[model samples]
Target: MDSNNLDRELVGVLFPGIVKNEDKAITCLGGIRNISQVYSNPSKRRLGLSFQPENPFVRKIYGNSKKGAGVLLKVKVKKVKEGNEIKREVVSTTVVGCVKTMFRFESMCDFQYLAVHREGPSDGPVSCCLEKILPSGVEVIDFMLQPSPLLLIPSSFTRFEKPIGYAYTDKRHPDRSSPEPGDSVHSKTRMLRSSQVSPYTFNLTNELPSEPHEVYVKQKEIKFDLHPRLIEEYDVVKKLFDERPIWSLNLIRYHTKIRLVSLKVIMPCLALYMKTGPWRSTWVKYGYDPRKDPAARKYQTLDFRLRHAAGVRSMIMSREDITTDRERKPKRSAAEAAAVSDEIAEGSVYFRRGMTPTQRHIFYQYCDIQLPEVEEILAPEPPPGYLCHQKRGWLPANTGEICRDHMFRYIKDTLFNSNNTDLKFEGSGNGSSSNSDDGGSDGSDGGGGMSDEGGFGSDGGGGASD
Candidate 1:
């Protein structure tokens, strides 16, 4: 193309493959006769139109020919039938160019090409020129064009929607109007629908490859089972057992050591029957024990007093317990409580004298004698036959030494001897010999007289040595 041609606005329609008949192809495209077929392979017949401000015709058609403009085309086809032949011809044509065409072109083509047209050419085809199949300036191509990976199209032709024969009625493309309702592009547009981007082309950097990364794994022992806390710790044990020779050796060594020490430690415990013995605690419980040590006796008394003091203090300070219990009894006003306290103080010998600081503090804090009587919380006496150092107030003191003496006697009988005639070996032998003499007198001889004489000579020699 020359400088003049470049300066002027130019529009090119690309018919993808070879055109077998230029006249037939031009005729098919130049009028409405091929509108249905044109819509069928819409992307194959792509259009690239230029909008240059220098072109006076373009400037007149589109108000601002400087930046952007729109174009609309309308064509009428007439079909005449003579005898058995039907002829189709382009009779009338109208093409409107305005700013609205730019917006319509962007929407229909994903901003990759101008508005798709199917019905007619922009003006009447009055001029014809011959040009090379491949133009010179198109030599440097950045990337190869292919259909979307998601959508698989075979060799057969498929119909795609294309908006045709537009009129310059509005500057904005109508969003409600769609040729194929469900055929909207699922992929991103060539240019973002933002004004900041170049609407004519796409940015290559944004389409970089995003392959997934491999995760790192730690090489550690494999555990077969999940623990209580779901942690894997004993994995090596299974592996060790799998090694036959190693596991056999380990088992032999462990069992031999266990057997060697087993009898020495276990026999005495079994003989003593310690496993079946009752357990005893060393901790102490208190009542009033005269036999207890002075320190222990003092400790028990102090503990009892402190517990009593705490119960009194709790009754004074706790609002819930005091308020609930007061409602159950006859209600007494503050004035009546004061009068009773004064009367108690005046009449009682203990309160008539001058009070110590502690006694005076207790009297005022616990409402003096106006306080209700508390139930006696007595401790239960320990059972009889219990062996302890403590003494109950009314029950007998523990005579644990008697139990100890009985245990010693039982041990002596088990270790040494028990008096029983049936258990004596010699006594049973003597009784059996005496009973046998009385029971039987007849005797039988099995050896000869010579054999008996030989035995008598051997017995005489044994008696001589003794």
Candidate 2:
């Protein structure tokens, strides 16, 4: 019954050591009220008489065979008490396992091993035993599953120091009041060969504040000649932003033939990368507001799926038997597939699919993952973006969604949090607004926050303003 995992009224049990087949499967095991003698009576049956079943007792129960089996139950007390009085010495029977039926007409019971308890105990590490599991952590099953590519989400979204998933994404705009501490890889990158580009140049704000392409593309003429190629690339980036308020790395590099190394320096000044919502991983201009621009609305939000396929299968075998991937990915050769076919026929119940959100709310009430309550009335859009952690590298199930998610988030954050234009507006209105304000004077709202170094927002704008 466990092998098939179905429900039925009757089944057959094949006990080990017995040589009987289907024909000889039927046997009368005497119980407290035997029905055999009553059916054997030669007299006519009485009209008013009723026959109710009693507790079944079958001896010589072949315990080993799995084909036809009955449910086994163990009662610890194993005795019936009389009216507040003892009857005789009590001998309790220990039921080994629970059984289910293969079919309705089954004469022999089809049984599978199931440990039925009033309440499930907490899980822990233990050993195995062929006999009953006398204590914790012991199991009849052999070796456990090893994760080949276990995947999780929290680690990917980790912060460097301060407890913020949001962090320094762009060097252009640094947070003012939050200590404005910034992380830099320059110390290490500067050590690299001159030809190599830095994985990071400098960024103090996460998801660089967004702005209008008109305002975002404005460039400052800095005299620094440390890298002459950077000036050439910066000019080209400004031109591209003129076409659109947002641009991803590939879109910029592929079309303009810009060196990625140059982009590492240029991008932080031009735009902020979103980590969640709508424009997930894309880089939006510093002054472009997608929220107000109907044309940009389409790029602000997107929808997709997130699936967990890494550790779905739970079949355990010897380390040697695990020749290929633990999850059996990559399509093993026919022989290898066939060899493990019969072995891993049964799937684990732990990963039951098609479960409703309501079901999960109940199942995972105490778990780290929980489904938030749904609202019949839609709430206004606010932009947003456990356990048993075995130490192993876990590959995400699908990457397309990851890219989409990042792009969406980039757009959303750029649209909502970015108000670069306000700084420009304030500067221009005061008339003391420096020349740097010209970069964002294109009549577009852009972000220009208080700069940590000197002028407006970032050093790039500071030099222009000065």
Candidate 2 lDDT tens digits, 1-466: 1333233333333322254543223222223133234233313211111111121111122122123457554444445679997656435555455454321211223222322222234464333222233324654444343322222223222222123355857543332122223744432221333312222122223333444233324432242256676787787898888877766564565466665546755776777655333344456777775444434432332222111112111111222444422133366897776445323111110112222121100111001111121110011222222111011001111211222223223222332245232322222322122222121111111112112112211221121121
lDDT winner:
2
Residue 77 of model 1, lDDT score: 91
Worst 10 residues of 2 by lDDT: 386-395
Q: After superposition, how far is residue 371 of candidate 1 from its true place, in Å?
A: 78
Q: Report the lDDT tens digits of candidate 1 across residue range 1-466.
A: 1122223342323443367966654443434444344334343432222232222121111011123443444568999999999999988765533232121123122122212223346564433111222233654443235221222224332132344675868624344233355565753234224222111111212321122111100111111132222121122232332332111111222333223122222211111111000101011111212222222211111000001111122212221233531123566998776454333222111111222111111111011112111000111233443332212111122111111122222322332243332332332222112211111011111111112221211221221110
Measured against the true structure, the TM-scores of the candidates, in listed sequence, are 0.10, 0.24
The 10 consecutive residues of candidate 1 with the worst lDDT sum are: 273-282
